[model samples]
Target: MRKPLPFGISVFVALMLLASQAFAAPKSDLWPMWNQSNEANAASFDHQKWQQILDKYVVVKGQHNLFNYSAVTPSDKALLDQYIVDLTSLDPRNYSKDEQFAYWVNLYNALTVQLILDEYPVKSITKLGGFLSFGPWDDDVTRIAGKKLTLNDIEHRILRPIWNDERIHYAVNCASLGCPNLAQTAFTGENTEELLNEAAKQFTNSDKGAKIDGNTLTLSSIYEWYGVDFGNNEQAVLKAIDVFRDGQKLEGWSGKIKYDYDWDLNQP
Candidate 1:
């Protein structure tokens, strides 16, 4: 009793449905899962080369850690490039969660440092990338497991989502003076927890991380931007910060929270 669609029209509708499905697929489909199985392989990934570079280039000047971007030799740059290539080649899902965690942390930091070195003598990391771009975060700077990824992809999609840990904020440096200092040592599976805790403590204790100015609380803009990632509210964010404050008091502090950040390159 009902008439069917014309053959040509039916075919067109089928194709349209297929196209919609393809377009609607989640972007996460393009990336490998952060963790595949609970069981993990003991296979080792070497980060000695990267550690050497960090040790030689990162300097601790008082409260800030500065990188000698201008002093990086051509040979050192080559080593850095090779290290990234090796890191991106691995299937992170094949490793344990801790190993994978270290992998991403090191990769993110290494890529950031490389970005600065490639465009050294610049005033800020934000100055790199396309005309319409805010920074290199959205640029597909590396390929991992057959998928191209930007710094944003690694930090937001993979690292933050998988770990769901606030300390990660301190782990991934933005190569800016106001950001948490880039550690002088590389992150590894064996030391991942230790390093993350240390980084958080160091940052919270520093003025750039948090400062109480009279009746107002001046905090890093990171808290304002990614406050949800920390605890989803101002009070929760302050509690998270206080965890690393080492008993320092912000007593008589006003509830007013002001945010500030410096985009200047953390250069020596």
Candidate 2:
């Protein structure tokens, strides 16, 4: 008969294994910028269901992108503020690389929407400047998991790192009419592929964004913001735009219309 292993050793090994698994998984889904499930307008909370989704992804405590935040959503602004524990208070040393990225992206979006809600009736986010002389979008006042984070931190640091893919720009929205309509579902790494594709297709194809009038082109200014993301150069970007332009020739598509941004919160 073999002697039983020491309790301390056994517990240590078990904990180590558990920790490994946590890092192996990613946190959250890769849904579009504005994702609300069925009854999205309701903005109801389903803790069990939400945990199930987050469980599939890795969780890095205290880790943040450039911004101190690690997750944010239109509805989350209230939930996190009122209920969810501070995620950024956790330790970053324990988080995996992908886990950190996931956390930061979510945080940025969450805080942004929250900022808008803070001043819901405003005509534009640009009007939110204060003594800081900048919008909350430029604020570095939150934490992710357990690390300090800011809005820019999420966009340039993490999201840009993992997918260096420009289409992502179209996927991550800023809660403005000029931005893509937010999806009503969560964004998980599992469905990131479909999410990105759909966003690109949706924005480029919609006449609301870019349309062709017998060669006269009307394009969303997004074609101008981080335009390089659409292509290596403007020409390359135009090529990507053409995919959603309904086979219209870019040469003759020359319709000019002033671009507009809806400042209202993307809600029902």
Best by lDDT: 1
Off by over 4 Å in 2: 1-77, 82-87, 90-102, 131-134, 244-268
Which digits, one per residue and each the tens of the lDDT, describe model 1 over residues 61-81?
A: 877999889999999999999
Alpha-carbon TM-score of each model against the true structure: 0.86, 0.60
State each model's CA lDDT, in order: 0.82, 0.50
- RMSD to native for every prediction? 10.4, 19.6
TM-score of 1: 0.86
Tens digit of per-residue lDDT, candidate 2, span 166-228: 665665656555566443344453455676677677776666566656535666766655555
**In order, how many clashes per candidate?**
0, 52
> What local lDDT score does residue 117 receive in model 2, on the 0 to 100 scale?
57
